[model samples]
Target: MRDPVDKLSAMAIFARVVERGSFSAVAREMQISQPTISKVVKALETELGGKLIARSTRQLSLTDEGLRYYAECRQILAAVDAAEHSFQSGKERIAGHLRIGSSVSFGRLQIAPRLAEFLKRYPDIDIDLQLNDQNQDLIREGLDVTFRIGELNDSGLIARQIGITHRVTVAAPDYLRQHGQPQSPAELSAHNCLQFNLLNSQNLWVFENNNKRHEVRIKGSAQSNNSEAIREMVLGGLGIALSPVWLFSEDLKAGRVTAILSDYVAQSLPIHAVSPANRRQSARVKAFVDYMSQALDAAPELKPVR
Candidate 1:
């Protein structure tokens, strides 16, 4: 039988060396001699029957075998840590790491502010938030949950629809006065349309009129991948923009921008909390989703745009 102490020591040292990229760094961190770290690594490689790392005087790199081994080792270590944490916390409270993925605007304007409240309610839970406009692969990235603002296209993931987000065409009063307002979707072609480049149909603005939906292809002088930047530009009277009403409700209400094409409204996109189907019942995952759902329901700023 293998010695548990030796196995743990080997795993710990391996992880440290991989992270630090050198045996000397691990030795300095552990306050042990460099030779001792090397010995442990060599022993681990022998036990596993694979050369996990290629070491040199200048640099270190993992072999293909090492990369695969490290991936498995990391997962195993995380599971062990979670198990220990669960035992210590008595399973009554939400604990361990909860990684969340969300779009930049929604994450910043809505989700992030409520994070402190969540922490206060569940002190044991640690949150790691990743905010970007790009859609990420949740399972591959090891995310516990994600906030998606539009239609979910991934068939394998489970999505819980929390609320709906309306789309609107908005522009500064100055821009509308200077350039003239668009009375119909066709007239939008003559105006400077500020486009959000991340959307699947970036050039097309969808509008609904009397139960009929119309998609108008719009040309824009200004375009950006960042949604916040687009909103800022629109607020500054650079051009008209099509975006979710929730993103610009404050601006709309404060008279910074006016909603146009009011007669031809767009359909509301459902906001969803998505996760891998397999982890739908996970305690930490469920806790976060529930917390966010409640927080959103109570937030006055998230009210539907009329």
Candidate 2:
């Protein structure tokens, strides 16, 4: 090992001497000769061009300059210790705040429930989860990460596909019994289709057949910006809705809602984790996203939304 002869070492030694009120005590603690500790303190005072210590046969006291230098040295030493702790290990490193944005239904039913386990694994991490159906500007909103449905637009943000989600056209048994079930995508035009107002075009529903794409622009009796609201309206026998399968998983299992358009399926979109380009480098954001990905994969209702 090399000798601790640097200026920082000298400053630290001087601070320790001041803290202990004895050069001999600091020398014994550092496993160095008392004369060597005195030499290091003298060198430190010379370099700073200040008289740092007032010494007597009984004890030592810091001069005004020494008091200021000791305070500054404590700050420097604390910063060095913090830097070391931050990179020492994963548990120590991933300690910080994480601001996450996600859609309402997905956040509550998917991400929020699984966060308990994530927090258990990273007790040092604090999560701030904001849920809304509307799109968010990650950088402008000061969000560390966000979950977005569908293909991401080209922008400064970094995006990665985390899972697959698809829409299912469903109606309550009462609603279908009253209005009659639509046999084809085009027939949906004649039905009272509930709309998710958060979508850019609530009237347009796209479908695929024979590897060809087609669209149906239909009217609706009720609409809501929130997925849960639209889901509730559908359950009340108000209208049909194209919704995420997981949102209606319980109803589907109980046979309260019936899925339609078996021949022409609604397209599946990739759910994504979007972050500011700079935030993509953050260990907290990456760890959170990775945990969310695993949790989503294990969700029985989600099932990749195929």
Candidate 3:
């Protein structure tokens, strides 16, 4: 039996094993032996009095109990991370350069607007903000942290859901007045939909009604690879646009852009703060992500509409 101090390490190893689906993978990543990894998991299952993983020759899969346990483990690890940060603040300024990657529109309208606060809080830390509307290899780009909006499939990466963001269909009141509003997702096909040419909503828009999903294929004369450009075209009365709500939240409230088809649920795209999977996250990276999560939670624009 190991000391109580080693129990947390074992729990983390168990979580990583479930995440990676291979004992060897976790062992290689953690720089520990394969037997040590197996022993940790064995000890965990022994302590819990049940099997967490149903291991086979090919891969590992979590049992029902394991799935529930994994969720609790992740929550506990996050709380431990926060507790660690709370005590380390009085030491010195968290001085480091953060190379962050994000979408151009989100970096400009959302993240950039909040930078002054982060900079003010961490005077010694500097940020290298790279804004592009495409996915880049995190390690190859040498980024300290990157914010992505979809599922994190890589076992080598860690994801944190900061808040929820969803695709919103919007139109300038003038344009809506001219063409009349789309009463349903089916009506959008007849409208000149401004395409962002990115993500799932590029040439297709998705909605939910009566617990059934509707995917509408749309076309328009104007298509932009950038989201902000799509916003500009929508504002110009070029046509209606399906965009992230945060891009035009204030406009929806101020009546500049009208949100139609309220009965159908717009596609849900939850906001995420992703970083490469590491047992220890840097002070600057941790601080920035935590601050962003808090900021996003408080923002009315990023919230999902019922």
Name the top lDDT candidate: 1
The lDDT for every candidate, in the order shown, is 0.82, 0.80, 0.80
Candidates' TM-scores? 0.75, 0.69, 0.66
Report the number of backbone clashes for model 3.
Answer: 0
Candidate 3 per-residue lDDT, tens place, 1-306, comes to: 467658777877887787667899888978989999998899899999999999888878889999898878866765564455454546423666687989898988889999999999998788989888887566445466778775555667777888777768889999988999989999999999988766754787889999999989998899987888998898888999878888998788888888888899888776677775543466778889999999988987787654
Q: For model 3, what is the error of residue 104's alpha carbon versus the real structure, in angstroms, after optimal superposition?
A: 0.8
lDDT of 3: 0.80
Per-model C-alpha RMSD: 5.1, 15.3, 10.4
Worst 10 residues of 2 by lDDT: 76-85
> What would the per-residue lDDT of candidate 1 be over residues 43-129, giving only the tens digit for each residue?
999998989999788998999999887767666665665556555346634677788999999999888988898889888888899
Ranking by TM-score: 1, 2, 3
Model 2 CA lDDT for position 188: 92
Residue 157, model 1: Cα distance from true site in angstroms: 3.9
